[model samples]
Target: MKYKTICLIIFSLILLQGCVAIQSFPTVARAGDTVTLALGSSDQINIADTTVTYTPDGGVAVDLTSNVRSIFKLYPDRASPAWSFSAASGIPVTSGHSASVDIMVLDLPPGLVPGTGVIRVQNNAVYPIFSDIPSDADVAIEIVPGVGSPAAFAYSLFGNATAGNFTSLEAAPHFRIKPDFEPNAWYQAPTYAAAELTISGTLNAAALAATESQVTGQLRIIVDEMPTSLASQKQVSWARNGGDITINYLSPTGKMAYYETTVAVFFAASNYSFTATPNVSIRYFDIDGNVVTGPPVFIKSCTNATGCI
Candidate 1:
């Protein structure tokens, strides 16, 4: 009777071993990175009659049984405004134990600001049989902004002049400017007239002529007094009494340099009675002395008599 009991116990132990022989899936991924679930030994396990299903915590889950391997992928649900993804084939796990279906996350989609999400993986071979083989992993992503390029100057005008310079007497001469930059760089918009203008006005013929003469004499003195680190300097003289005016610019080292064009305005006494419009083109430069080469922006100045539009 005892020998019979020992045989029965051995048989029961063998059956128990078979029931526990089923292999379990493993999860792989970084705390803040993408999740990849790998089925190490799908061939060694008795999954011929079973299907494996996985569920991600914060990303899209894909089945691995479609491919020839046993590898699955999960995409995180993070936000990145400028993120994007590309099409990818399934990653091979083993020779014949690869994923039945290939799954991949495209380049992070643009406009995914940045954040964290959860990813989960599970097996759905047989309902309630091995369905409890679910695993979860955390995923995190970060997005950063790009740098901006430099800009250049096209044209500029300073001081008062006759209305004939502009297309419309009603519209003050507008200055158009541009900047140079790379295709995808962030640039701080420049602020105009931020620095107060120490001098502004329309001088009559006599006044203009006198100012020009004085400027010629004072030019040397001014250059000697200016600091060496200065980049460039400009001085404009406009006549209100229907006369011609001149503009002179000096470089940082006190030498007369012509980096820009000049326009001469002749204002007659008759033109003085009407509103005068001056056209100016301004160029923006960075600390490195590089001109911005972007689209041009317009700037306008008008007198109260022009209906103040």
Candidate 2:
């Protein structure tokens, strides 16, 4: 009697989870800000080579590159540097692992139509011991339609310098900044990308033309980076052009890296924290030098708040 050969193959994608779960901040995220995909650790799957992708709501798929093996892999419950606020996301892990990624909304690959978006994660087998481990997961993220938010972020203008404390106009607009993540562990370093902020507003061109003559920095933009019990700040120096002032900072690549930081932007006249009247705009940008997110800050003058002096 002769016996025949038999083969059995297991499909991991069919057994794995793609849209595991997403835990993001501010619930509602605007363009230019940062959003997160809360994929648990990698130890659960027995091996670690995973990939990330972004598919805008009503758009195409975008590949997100993350190399864990090169960045230090974490086991179940073994906190990864990028896992900031992971517990809040409720990632699935008992025998499984999860990882979290923080991405600037604008950095996301442009969606086909720009409506709803999804983040997908997949684990591939890199060796024989890790074979048959092809699995995938998905998470949801909503992209709002406009750039400027109605948040409390504001700015103050100071063209008329009074003993270094500029006596200027003020305006506040909506603003939300993506905070930076810190990875205080071995082999953990967050990646950084450039984030540029454009500060602009209507000037009493007439008043400015008369006394101050231009919308220059007397009271410049301010940066606030804080933690629960600790806090720090700095004044942002901007490159000014008539009514537009540009501020730039390189944001960390992800929440995964250690020894990195992030901050928010605000406007002030000189070094003094003075209030402003409405009539200014604030916006955000990408490395491409385009407006990715923000609203025009509105400004009003001490002499006139509307229609140039």
Q: Pick by lDDT: which candidate is best?
A: 2
What would the per-residue lDDT of candidate 1 be over residues 90-153, giving only the tens digit for each residue?
A: 1111111111221221122223223333233333222111211223222222233332221121
Q: Given candidate 1, what's the lDDT at residue 228?
A: 16
Pick out the ten consecutive residues of candidate 1 with the lowest summed lDDT: 86-95
Q: List candidate 2 stretches off by more than 4 Å.
A: 1-19, 44-48, 66-113, 125-136, 147-309
| Count of backbone clashes, every candidate in sequence | 66, 45
Quickly count the clashes in candidate 1.
66
lDDT for each candidate structure: 0.26, 0.33
Q: Top TM-score: which candidate number? A: 2
Worst 10-residue lDDT window, candidate 2: 1-10
